[model samples]
Target: MRRITLTEVGDRAGVSRSTASLVLRGSSKISKETARRVREAMDELGYVYDRSAANLRHARSMTLGLVMNDLRNPFLADLAVVFERSVRRAGYTVFIGYSGDDLGDQQQMLSAMVEHRIDGCLLMPAAGTERESLKVLGSHEIPSVLFARHLGGAEPYIGPDNVEAGRLLGRHLRTIGVKEAVFLGGPSPSSARAERLAGLREGFDGRVELVDGGLTDSTVSSDSGSKAVSRLLGDGTIPDCIVAYNDIIAVGVTYELRLRGFEPGSDVAVASFDDIWIASQQVPPLTSVSTHAEEVGLACAEELLAQIDEPRQNGQKLIAPSLQVRASTGSWRPRKEDR
Candidate 1:
C-alpha cells in the first residue's frame, strides 16, 4: 500500500500542503486551532509527514555533528557521551565522526558534515589541519565550537586550562624531588600539548632536566609510550619521573617499566592527564590532572546552542583542571631533604 502523503491530510483538513507542513513542525505563526485540525487530519488519514524533508525546507537538519581526533581515548569517549546527552535533551540529534589524527580524514569528515546539512558542529580538530577548512566552516556560517583541542584562528572553543594542568603536574613532581623529568607527549602542534609543555616548564623553572618523548601528532597510544620508554632506556637518560600525555600512554609506560624490572611508583614516579578510569585501576594507580571531560562536553553543547540563538557572541571559554594525587606518585610523602 502507498504511504499516506501530506497532501491527503491537507485535503482532508481543507488546508494547503505548506500550511500542513508548518503546523506539523509547530511553527508559532500557525494558529492552535489550525494546528489541531491538521494533526487530527493526519491521525485520521494515517498520514506521516517526512520530518527530514520538512527540516530541509527550513534549512536545518535538526542534527549536530561531532568530530573527534581520537575516539579510542577515554577522555574523548566520555566527552562524546556528554555531548550526546545534552544535544538530545535540547531536541536535537548528534552524529559522531572520528578523524584519527589524519588531515585527510578530518577534511573528509568535514565535507560529510556539510553535505549532511548539520545545523552545527563540535570539532576536536586533528593536529595540522589546514586553516582554510576551518575558514570554510565560518564562511558557511554554521555554528561550531572546538572541544578538548582548539584550531588556532578559528571560532570559539571550550577546553581545560592545559597550561595550568601542566604546571600542576610539574609542581607535584618538583615537590616529590623529581629533578630529572620526562614528558611523554603526542604531536607538537596540538594545543593541549603546547599549553601543557609551557605550563610544565613554568612549574619546573629549569630545576629539572626535561626529556622529549617525541610524540608529534596528538596520537596518545600505548605503543607510543612503550616506544618512548624503550628509547629512554637505550639513551641511558631515565628520569626520576614520567608525565604522560594521557591515561593510555601512562598505562603503557607503567607496563614497559614493570617489564624492565622497574617499579612504577618507587623506581620512577608516573603521572598523566585526563584522570581516566584506568588511571585509578593501574597496578599502583596513577596521579593525574582531571580535565573534567563531561563538563567540557556539556559546555561545548551549550556554546553551540548559544551561537545558534545569538551568533554575535564570540570568544573562548576555558575550564579549569584539578589534580588527583594517588599511589602512583608514591603516597605523596614529604621528603626530609630540607630538614
Candidate 2:
C-alpha cells in the first residue's frame, strides 16, 4: 500500500507543503481556518508525516530517552508511568530501555538513543557505570538527566536523597527502642545503597550496632532479600531490627523471618525504602521511607524539558524521602521496657 504523505495533504487542501508542515507542527503563524482545512485534508487523505525526517531537519526529535536499571522493580515501573505521562503532556514522546545493571548495556542504550537522535535523556544508571561513560553523553551534547540513582559525572539528577531515606529508617528503628539493626542490600557500588547506609549511620549516631548483610547486587528483588536473610542467619548476625534497601527486600526479610518461626513485628522489626504498593499488603504492613516514584519521574521530565529550552543550565536537584510508619516496624503499643 502506498503511504500518504504531507505533500498529498497539501495538494488536497490547496496549500503548499511548508504550510502543511506549519499546521502539523502547531505553528501559531497558521490561521485557524487554514489549520482546520489542513487537518481535515490530512484526515481525509490519511496523511502521516515522516516525523523522523522532519525531526532530523529541525535538529529536535520531540522525543526523550529513559534508561533504568530494571523495569521489573515496582518503583521503577511506577516512575516510568509518571515520566511517560509528563513527557506526553509536554508534547514529546518517550523511549525507555532497561540496562539490567550492566555498564556495557548502558553504553549500548546510550549509543542507540544517539543514533535515533533523541533530544534529551533521563538515565537511572547501572551500578557499574564509570565517569568515562557519563562523559561520553556530555560530549555528544545530549542533555541527559539522571533518575533514581546518580552517576557522579552526570549533569543533573532528580531522585530521592538516599542518605535521608536511610536516616529515616534508622531513626524509626531507634525510636521503637531497637538498639541493634541489620542493613541488608546489594553491592557497595550502588549509590542508593551506599547513601542509605550513610544516612542510617547518621541517624544512629554510632550508638546502634549495624550488621552488614550484603546481597548479590543492587536489584531489590524478593529473592535477593531472602538470600541476604539466610546469609545473616548463617553468620549469626541477626539483630533486633532489619533495615532493607527497599520494599522488595523488606518483603523478603518478612517472609524469611516467618519461615524461621519468628514473628516480624514481635521478634524483629523491619523497615525499608521505597514505599511500593506491596508494602501495605504484607502480613505485617511494612514501615518504609517513601521516595515518591511518580514525583521523581515528573521532576526528571521537567528538568529535561527545561534543558531543551535552555541548554546551558547546570547543577543537580535532590528530592527527599518521606517516612511512613506501619505494623512491620512494631508500630503497635511499645513494651514497658522499650519506653
Candidate 3:
C-alpha cells in the first residue's frame, strides 16, 4: 500500500508542498483558504500525519496528556469527554491516563506521559497525592493544570466550588426543616470533601447537629452509604435529613431508609452533591448540588492550554455551583422568625 505524503496532498489541493506542510504543522503563516483546502485534500485521501517524524524534526510531539483519578465515576468521565473535545479543537491530540485513584499509579502514569514527550498535562490527582509525587512533572518543566483535586501547591487548578456546593446543600436542608442532619459515607482523604464539610457547617451556622457517618476510610459507593447509614441507625441517631457525599451514596441511603419502613421524602428528606442523571430519576427525585462537570472540564482544558503556551501563568479556577431542588427535599418558604 502506497503511503500518502504531503506532496500528494499539495497536488490534490493545487497548492505548494511547503503550504501543505505548514498546514499540517498548524503554522499561522498559511492562509485560511489554503489551509482549508489542504486539510480537505488530506481528509479525502485519508492521509494521517506522521507525528513521530515531525517530533524528531521539531521539538514538539503535538500531543497533550490528560491524567484523571478514576474514569468509572460518571462526573470524571463527563469531564474527560468535554476536555477531549476542547483540546482536539485546539489542534492538539490527547492521551488519557487513569490513575485508578492510587498515588503509585498517578506517579507511574505521569512518568510514562513525560517519557512519551507529551506537550503538557491536565491532572486530576489521586486522593492522597503528595507534593513530592507531583514534582516529577514540575522538575521536568512539563506544564500541568490540576483539575478536581490539588496537592496544595502553586500549580494551576480548575474545579467546582466544593465549599459553596456544600453550603448550598446545607442551606437547602435547613430551609426544608432539617434541624438535625447526618452526613452519610465518608471521611475521604480528598481536600474537596473537607472543604465541603466545612461549608456545610458554615451554612448551618452551628444550628444543625451534624452526626458523623462513622466511615473509617474514603470510599464513595452505594454499599458504603447504606452501611454508614445503617451504623448511624444502630447508634440511635435519627436524622431529620440525610446528606450523602454524592448522588450514588444518596441513592443507597434512600434505599436503606425505605427498607426500614421510612418514606424518603415525607418521613426524612435526602440531599446530595453531584446532580448526576440518576439524581432526577430516583424513586423520589434527589435534591442535589450541581457541580457542572462539563463546564469545569472546559475550564481545565483552557487553563492547561494557557499554561502550555505560557508556563509562568498559574492560578486556581473555581467554578460556581447551584442547588437543584427535587421531591426528595421539599422546598419551603423562609419565615421571618427563621431568618
TM-score of each: 0.79, 0.79, 0.78
How many pairs of residues collide in model 3? 0
RMSD (CA, angstroms), candidate 1: 11.3
| lDDT of each candidate versus the true structure | 0.81, 0.81, 0.81
List, residue by residue over 1-339, the lDDT tens digit for candidate 1: 788988789899998765676676577667799999999998898887677775554476788889997788889899899889998999899888988888889888888887787888888988876567775565455778887777766467899999999999888888778887788867667888888888999888888777766763346788888878877777787577888988889888898898888888887888999898988899898999999999998898899887664443254788999999998896543335522
Q: What TM-score does model 1 achieve against the real structure?
A: 0.79
Backbone steric clashes in candidate 1, count: 3
lDDT of 2 by residue, 131-165 (tens): 67875566556778887777665357788988888
- Misplaced by over 4 Å in model 2 are 1-58, 331-339
**CA shift of 84, model 1, Å:** 0.8
- Decide which is better by TM-score, 1 or 3: 1
Give the Å shift of residue 289 in candidate 1.
0.4
TM-score of 3: 0.78
Number of clashes in every candidate structure?
3, 0, 0
Candidate 3's C-alpha runs over 4 A off are 1-58, 214-217, 331-339
Expressed as tens digits, the lDDT of each residue in 163-253 for candidate 3 is 9999988887766667878877643577777877888997887878886575634666788788877777777776778888888788889
Clash pairs detected, candidate 3:
none
